[model samples]
Target chain A: MGKIKILNPGLLSTIQDGGRFGYQQYGMPVAGAMDLHSLQLANWCVRNPAHEACIEATILGPTIEFQSDTYIAISGATIQPFVNEQAINMNAGIKVRAGDVLSFGSIQTGCRIYIAIAGGFDIPELMESKSTYLRGNLGGFEGRALKAGDELEIADYERRLKGVVPEELIPNYSNFTEIRITSGAEIKRFTMDGVKTFLCSVYSISPQSDRMGYRLSGQKIEHANGADIISSGIVTGAIQVPGHGEPIIMMSDHQTVGGYTKIAQVISVDLPLLGQMKPGDQIKFKEVNLDQAQQLLLERNQWLKQHGIE
Target chain B: MIEYIPSGDSAFLVKFGNEISEEINRKVRAYFIALSNKKLEGIIECVPSYTDLMVLYDPLKIQYKSLLKELKILAENISEIEIPEAKTVEIPVCYGGNFGEDMDAVIAHTGLREQEIIEKHSQNSYLVYMLGFTPGFCYLGGMDKSIATPRKEVPSQKILAGSVGLAAEQTGIYPIESPGGWQIIGRTPYRLFDPNRKPEFLLQAGDYLKFYPISEEEYYKLNEND
Candidate 1:
């Protein structure tokens, strides 16, 4: 067993695993890490299962103190990380000696960062998940974001080994801003012009965005058919356009059901990219067919497996 | 009738016509029951709403195309499957006065006497169309059109659990304290949702609810035991 002490928890930090499943009927949102790709990569670096609990840091990163020797990895947003004033590379596992201080600077790109320690974070499971649902105040460190001075226990790992992730394996941040999406149920309701505008125009992430949803400020994509859609179940990455025509991308903490007309849905593979986007970040949507989207996901999964991440 | 289409990679939406009607609501409930019984693999959950059903699945185990194909087949076969009658539960409620702060507003909107409104509300049997918006919150159908009224102009910041409310042609019971826009006319003592319970939600989609008016004395009696 190991322990970590937070010296300065920046912005919002919480323990998250994959998500809470099999509870939609009970009206529980599937709360988890926003940037799942980075979370998995960090976990893989430490040889932990891809779904183990990790620290999801948003906007800012935390300063931590290690009470015992352990291996840790940082991924997602480009944060200049250091251990006792020595710079460390992101995405590769680093061995930290007892009493060493681990700190991170402001993010250079992206909004959220994921930190994975060997084994995983020690947190109680609620409804079979360690993910925190802030709305309901359930799971993960008393159902809230981690604050300064909070001590976190680390699960014991059977084996602790330093691992290196090649630079080629890391996602190219320059090409990471573009998001792929599949047209939604109400796609036909919009005119051809509306569709064209949605694909061509750039949208800025609104400051109102949070875990519940990301509201976008962009070109108005009107519904030509003037049909009032009935309420239906919504998932993460759903781009719902309300009466005002502004699109809102549902996030991990989005409501189980909504009545707005969804113009498109961000592909699952690119959802993590959307998760890392901060307020005022410009985003453009590229439409792709379902087959192509699945193919992309399959290729990504295979790449991870080939790199010993599975 | 309306068409069903893909909402996202993991879910499909079965949409009904523009207006909310009993026929469409019943079909949504029946289809939900049919899908629940089928127990398709990789399917995580299904949620029924006012006039639609959202089916969520796992993309890893099931591809979007294959799941869509299965859903098309399920949609065609839904009418053939027999739907079981919902379980009828009588919920005791305390009407008017401070218990229902918006009782006067409902009366003024409907132009009906307080007693008449209560009689009409309690006399009808409602079907639980869905559980959404909040935890254990039930969206009930079969409300009489005469008492139909729009939602409040400004929603209340806090509505106590077990508060009975009406919005437009729909009525529901709040399972937990939450912000709401519906006109509240009464309060029930029964606990609609309790996380500590095995099932968590007392009423599932497709259940039947009947309101039974109770005096203040009976309300306190039930509250005392709980």
Candidate 2:
């Protein structure tokens, strides 16, 4: 058992696992970590299950004090994390002795970060998940962002006495900024010119983006008809265009049902890439077939397993 | 009959039509029951919405093509299957005054007396078409056209739980406190959604609902009893 004390809860930080599934029938959103890839990588570094509960730090991160000796890993955005004012390396497992102070600087590229502990953060599960839903106040640390002075308990698991990390298991965060997308159900609703514009033009992430969805500011994609779609189940990476042609990519905390016409869907393999993007970052969408998307995901899974992450 | 389309990488949607109709609603409910009982492997959940049913599945376990093929078969088989009998529930509600603030607006829109509207609404048995918009919020069918009214232009910041309201052709009870635009006529004391409870939701889709008007004293007494 171990404890972590928060000294400076950053912009937004919350405990998250995989997600809440099988509850969308009751209008519950599948609230989970935005950047799942980073979460998995962080957990892998700590020798924990990839889906184990971890801290999802947004923009910046809180100053933390370790109450006991534990192994930890940091992934996602280059936040320039430090321990006792010394720069800590990103994407590598490190042992933290008791009373060590950890702090994070402003995001240099991405918007989010994941901090994983050896045994994972201990939080009550709701609907088979530890992810937080702020709107419903359902899971993870009272279903809200972590605050200063907050203490978190770490689950008990078999720990490795010797700190052993493979050299090649480290992830390259530089190439993940680009996002890939697939054609959505309402893709045909947009004009041929609109589709061309979507694929060709570059857009910037709007400041209004959050866990619910990322609102992008770019050239308005014109639709052929003024059709209002019925509210239906939406998934992460669904690029929904409301009355205004500006697209919003639905994320983890997005509503179970949405009425906007979805023009494109960010491919599952590239959703993590989008998750790392911060406001003002330039983004370009490249179209890919479903088969390619599936292949990419399979390749990613194989890569993880090959590196000792099951 | 409706067409099933791919929603995303992990789900498919069966859309009935653009307009709302009783026949289509019943078809959707029956199909939902059929699919639930079929129990396809890798299928995580099936959610019935206003005019569509969304099916979520584990992409790692089941390929998209095979799942779509199975759904197509299910859609073809839905017409021959019988829908299960729905449980009948009698819900007690307190009309107007404090609990329902939009009673006057509903009365004005319908151009009917408040008592007459209450009598009409309480007289008919409503069918739970779906549960959505919020946890335990039951989307009910069978509202008399005479009392049918449009939703508020500006939605209220907080509509109390169990507040029964009408929006266009549909009427529903708010299971949780949320921002809504429906014209509320009454509020129920029974908890619609309690996470501590075994089932969580008090009602499910396809359930039969009968609203019984109660006094303010009765509402408080029942609340205290629970």
Candidate 3:
């Protein structure tokens, strides 16, 4: 069995897969990799399945020591990775032997990084996913962030696939990001002026942002009526406007239901861009129709399929 | 008439009404049952809330327009949909002690005695509106507003699992230990969430919940069993 020992746990690191499905009705948040595009690309570098669990490090990354031979890939962010004191390339698979030290240097850009092993992490799956939901304390590495001295078991693979992802597929995670969105279910609750203000104004990510949701501060969005609404199911990327008028973008670990008005939903194609945003990052919303958003999703999926990354 | 709204690329909201009512909840449940029974291709799951149901689907397998057409037809005849009888769960609580640190505050808010509060709370059966906030946490309705109290000004740092709390027109049991602002008045020994259990959730959206007062001795007995 392949194994690795964590030395420095960094800021926030956890195991993640596609997400925990079939449990949202039970109030279980679908915790998954925030930057799914990077997760998929990392897995592809090692020739692992798209849904395989990977280590997601936010802002900072961990120092680890490999205990067995394995092929691994690091993607997302501009974190400098090293193997046994030798610098390695990002978005490329590398072979590590037993006792090799794996570490990361400074993060040059983006907020999160993904590391995928050839055969994935051998972790227990709750609700059919290894994704960790820390609040619920279910799934993945005992349902919490990795700490020093934690040992992770890796699955065995007969052969290793080593390659680098071409530059065309890699996303540029800029500090100032333009997140595209479609009008939400309660868009009508806002006045035309409110919608225009929302689409035009720039917002800064608040420090309180986490996997649950990103609290944004910007110009107040004036609603035609009070912001209260009957509680309804909420999905990831939903931009909920509370009585305070600030919009909060729900993320992978967001609550299943909310009572505030949702003015927009960041389109699927731009959710990855939102995921890479860190505190103090500036974002502006660009409106797109539902058809256009879906078409974008279709195009993204087609690209993933053609590139054999899905 | 049912209204369909786009939630995101992968899901859509089927709204039954703008108000929260048992009739509206029943409609939500009816449609959820119908769609669940049909096992429509590409539909992943349905989450039922107070007045709407969020249907999640695989975009690769189905389109929102086609799914909306199917939902429109299915929702039209919700009155005819048959679902399994909702289970009425009896949750035992020991009130007014260390278990309920905010019991005196609740009495002050409602101008009612401790016993009166307990009696009123246990006498009525509540409907499970939805499970959210935390795993297995139920949002229940049908509380006697006479004893209704607002949430604590400052929420507790940590509330143990199964703590029954009352907050502005609603009452619920915390299924897991979490930081909350609810005015806690009691605790139960029953486990609301067990990952090992087949149906991890003890209650569903349409289930009925009834709280009964239990003695401290009985509480210890049940706690030991868990």
Which runs of model 2 end up more than 4 angstroms from their true locations? A161-177, B16-18, B79-82, B150-155, B224-226
Sorted into a CAPRI-style docking class, model 3 comes out as medium
Candidate 2 per-residue C-alpha lDDT over B1-226 given as tens digits, one digit per residue, 9 for 90 to 100: 6677776666778887666666676667787888889999989888876677888876777878888898889888776888777788999999999888889998888899989989998999988777766667776788898999999999999887788899988788887788889999899998888765678777777678999999999999887223
Query: Which digits, one per residue and each the tens of the lDDT, describe model 2 over residues A200-239?
Result: 8888889898898889899988888853676667778889
Candidate 3 lDDT at B24 equals 91
Candidate 2: true interface contacts recovered: 0.45
Give the least accurate 10-residue stretch of model 2 chain A, judged by summed lDDT: A161-170
Q: Between prediction 1 and prediction 3, which has the larger TM-score?
A: 3
lDDT measured at residue A9 in model 2 versus the true structure, 0 to 100: 82
Q: Rank the candidates by lDDT, best first.
A: 3, 1, 2
Better of 1 and 3 by DockQ: 3
Model 3, A1-310: lDDT tens digits are 8899999989999998899888888888899999889998899899998878999999998999999999999999988899988999889989999999989998888999999998998887887899998878778998899999999999997687686888888998788999999889999999998898899999999999999999999999989899989888999999999989999999999999898999999988899888899999999999888778888889889987777777
Pairs with steric clashes in candidate 3: none
In model 2, what lDDT does residue B110 have?
83
Provide the fnat value for model 3, as a fraction from 0 to 1. Answer: 0.73
Using lDDT as the measure, the top candidate is 3
